[model samples]
Target: MTAMSPTPHDPLGAVLPPSPDNELDTLRELVSSTYLNHDPSLVTIRAGALFARLKALNRAANHATRAHKQATADSRQEMDHTYLGLQNLLYEKRHLEREIDKCRQFASVYQDIPVHALEDFMQIAPEEAPLNSPNAKGAPQLDLKRKELIKEKEALLKESKAQLATVENVKTHIDNLMKTATDVRRKVNDLVQPLPTTSEPGQSTPAS
Candidate 1:
């Protein structure tokens, strides 16, 4: 008994792959199978399904691209804003530093005087124009007046010192005079007191 050949649907024969017994018959079968599946509606339906899937994917990709672009733009805007703020801060810092340097320069210009004299100097030289202008002819007169006042003060101080010395000398002389008067008074009291004369024991007779 001969063994039967494998059927077309046999799993083992399909795995092994059939040898070509008839090339013409195989070609005819391929054409018939292709014709059977060539339904226009079926092809259209599959093509439509594939197109829909691609459209959905493209839409998702477009949404993602737009979101990414928006996020990038927002980040760039934030960075620009931050950079602008930094620039403003830098400008302000430089301005403040310049102001501080000016203040330091002003302070240095006035550093020669004692701290206590600044208020008096400010009172004296309140404006630069008055100090620099030579047209203020009264300045010379005022300066002369100031010099005379200084001379008067010096003369008064010298006179007061001399007067103080004279007063001290007078006080010393008065103290010495008082001491001399006390000594003279003591000497007068001693001279006025009578010396006692002693009489002998037997003379009792004469009354004066």
Candidate 2:
């Protein structure tokens, strides 16, 4: 007899030691001897007993295989969910940073009203305002300039208020996102925790 050669992909050819082709032949012969050909009742009884035991073992193996597949699928789904959560957090973080930059730029542009300058304008007479001013014959022009400055100051103050409101809104949104992320992390941790195993009602621990 010649030994089979191993394939390149499987150097051992077989993962485990080979089994005897007639391993169960001895057991079959024992059963046949115990239930002789003349006794049909005994043969039926032995055959039924053997079939029931094999059927139970097969059922258990099938159930275990199904459970293993389900567990693998559940783990994959959890990983996908966690990845999606991280993506959302990254998007929110970037958005928050961009909003912070806008807030900083707006803050730099904001200024307090020029109250002292307005007071100086108020002290000047309506007609002789420019007569005593450096730009002599430009009293009307000076008055117009004062009015323009007052309007511009009011506009600047309005814009500053709007910017503050926007900053507050951005801050609120960022806080909400942070809270959501924390909640998701807590939920994932809780879900990932293993449940305690309990013994079956009729089972007992093995003695050491």
- Going through the candidates in the order shown, the clash numbers are 0, 0
Candidate 2 — number of clashing residue pairs? Answer: 0
Q: Per-residue error at 23 for model 2, in Å?
A: 18
Cα lDDT tens digits, model 1, 122-193, are: 476657746445645456665565566668756655665665565555456545555554554444343333
lDDT value, residue 169 of candidate 2: 68
In angstroms, the error of model 2 at 67 is 3.0
Indicate the residue-level lDDT of 24 in model 2.
Answer: 31
Q: Tell me each candidate's TM-score.
A: 0.34, 0.38
Clashing residue pairs in candidate 2 (N, C-alpha, C atoms within 3 angstroms)? none
lDDT of candidate 1? Answer: 0.46
Best by lDDT: 2
The per-model lDDT (C-alpha) reads 0.46, 0.50
lDDT of 2 at 117: 41
